[model samples]
Target: MEEELVQQSSSTWPPPPPFWQAFTPENIARIEKSRQQQAEREGVEDASNVRLHDLPRELRALQPPLEPADGEWRVFGDKYRLVDELPKLEDMQIRRLFPNPEDRDRDGKHFDRALILKRLAKSLLLNFLELMGLFAINPEAAQDKITDIRDMFINFHHLINEYRPHQARESLISMMQAQLDRTRAETNAIRDAKDKTERIMEGLGSLKFGDELVGDSTPQKDPWATQREVWASALADIS
Candidate 1:
């Protein structure tokens, strides 16, 4: 009994108070205040994802500032040089399907962006022959994908004809940039959620793992070795 008392007394002096027991009115009030503040902050931040027309001009879109266009011409022109190279989008296919240049342009812009590429290539080829006289540059040698098309005419090239962006295209680009910004934001949110889950798992791991926990894991009572005979014997003894 004295040993027990000594052990109990030695355990801790003036035992630390419990961190939580039941919610008090003061605690509830503080929690409510914190929740309200968090909600307000979240509401303010959530507005960044939403575009409000009436908001200040600076606050309207959450995209990086687009650089002002220089008057120089830009062309997505590989589409011009590669049209003849494709077995599927052959000269026969283009002539049969879209005989008229106007029809070709309309269909390319409407149905598929590739047709637009074909039209641009033809225009560029004709313009080149008209200006520079015929050289043996085969359009077939040109190759690049949709994004690569952006850089196809970036450097000085006599074959490439530059295209100027119109007011409507600029507006469309602004909208596209906004959409890209939103997509990036959503991607970041998903990544943050994944990180949060990992952090929570790490926190749980920190609590569940320590020298004390490692020591506690040492096997004391185990049931794995007991078999059917042991159970039968135990039952018999009980009876």
Candidate 2:
């Protein structure tokens, strides 16, 4: 059954890579070359793997800084360069950061703020690139760049902080406008209710009560008025 399944799969048009022209003369030659190169690399690595401690002191020693007079200490010592040596950034990367040339201009007042931010970004990238390699070669020099990076970050945040007052004012204005709209709606509702009440009172005034009950000649006192008078008499007795 497994043999039948294998046959069925292999019969498809365009077999998988491992089965497609795998045993061709060109493929076999390529595979042999790859294996030979891999073996050569392994042999080279094994030959080069020497124990550092076993080597003579002179072979494993760094030259005295003073003897070189301006070389060894500068390369591998506790010295820092006064000016930063920045790595070159590609033109494409720079264009992606600031596409418009006018944005790079610092003289214009309107573009000045953006110009500073772009320059800060450029400085950060340069320092980051230098620090990547400098940390392994010179940690102190790498740490020096960190201070500038931090200052630039702080300046960026300061620029952002300038928008706080504007944001707060906009929020307050939006809240007050919403409150005013609600108050106006409430006022309109109350005015509508007053108008409806006045209309109902005018309708009631137009009706003639005497015409509706003409057969009854005697006048009757209102029950609510009698009840009020009784209450007033009870209060007078209490007094």
Candidate 3:
């Protein structure tokens, strides 16, 4: 009977059918419903995983109102007054530097006053420079060239001190000279290369016009161009 049952199970006609054969329309519908329910459960779980802080406030009153006027309010003794005066002083300085006749009435005639203040600032700065031994021949000569007090003070502190510890003044002069030298050298080199390229092109043009001269004779590339190609290949190999 067991042998007969095994033979029946093995028959191509089938006893009940394989597990895959059992997957009918109803079975497929049930599977789809289960998948949809699982997807909904996962979606709920994902929503729960999101942080509370990331959500928009349900109550608007929980968030603080913007306060732009807080910036305008003076905090701590005379700090705000000093901060307010800085813009007025800066305007005054700019007016003194670039004085306009038309805007005099609107902006106020503070040019002369600004100029006097600038001179006084310069004198005080020069006194400091003199104490630092920045000037050799004349301190007054150095004061005449100083336009921006902030820049002057910064250069005096950092550039002069750090770069030129012993001879700050001399180092400053040397730096300017070196910059000029480098500019001149670069300009001359560029000019020379331009002239050389023009000469090479003129020589190439003079060659007689024929297929023999210009054709398959491996178009004469510039020496610099050939060198650059060779250098590129070498770099590729190294890389």
Candidate 4:
């Protein structure tokens, strides 16, 4: 059995000398130098390849110039609702006080608080005038009884002085509210007519936008004013 055994050796049993060599400083320098030379030779051989600066004229011409990135912009809020409620002029009791707004004296009318008050009184006391006119018999005897009516008229004058502005302010607010409602309806109709992709924004500035009512602000026949003759007549009555 020993005589019959054969010896079989493998040639690839151990590594080569280069594989077993230590990384010395000089050897590393020499190896790096050889690698650089080899890389240069390869690059020269690969003529069709190009670096960034060496891009061909045609390729470079096709590429667009790089632009600076835009990372900021003006920003607006997506506010889309009314902030404050519209003035509720519908429930206000001002239209009953001064139905006419076109009456005004050409001279210093806005400053004439007394004249305005008196005119407002007369307009509000039409019923009393009719009553006084109806009971015009026995002028001297009825004067004492009619004195009550005069006193009542003076009381109404005081009431008008006290409450007329409040009424006017309310009327102004009411008219403004009506104007706002009309404008809102018009705006709504316009928006409805627009395409679906459009955006409608609200609540930017003041809640009461465009409050000018134009024609009706001081309309024809304003009841808060009187002719100077009306003042003379009232004064004569007082005397």
lDDT of each: 0.48, 0.60, 0.54, 0.50
In model 1, which range of ten residues has the least summed lDDT? 155-164
- TM values, all candidates: 0.22, 0.33, 0.21, 0.24
lDDT top scorer: 2
lDDT of 1 by residue, 111-155 (tens): 444454566576555554543332245434433232233222321
Candidate 3 residue lDDT tens string, 92-117 = 34323332335546765454534544
Q: Rank the candidates by TM-score, best first.
A: 2, 4, 1, 3
lDDT tens per residue, model 4, 1-239: 54333221233333343522445565545444544565587665443332234434433432234433452232232222233222222243222332222444444446445665676566547656655665775445656545545554554454455556678899999999999999999999887867433432332222433543433345555454678669989999999
The pairs that clash in candidate 3 are none
Candidate 1 stretches with Cα past 4 Å from truth are: 1-165, 209-239
List clashing residue pairs in candidate 4.
100-222, 100-223, 101-222, 102-220, 102-221, 102-222, 103-222
Q: What is candidate 2's CA lDDT for residue 166? A: 72
Better of 1 and 4 by TM-score: 4
For candidate 2, write residues 152-237 as lDDT tens digits.
67666555455567778999999999999999999999999999999998777667585454345568667589899999999999
Question: Can you give the lDDT of residue 120 in candidate 3?
Answer: 52
What shift in Å separates residue 91 of candidate 3 from its native position after superposition?
A: 38
- TM-score of model 1 (CA atoms): 0.22
lDDT of 1: 0.48
Q: Rank the candidates by lDDT, best first.
A: 2, 3, 4, 1
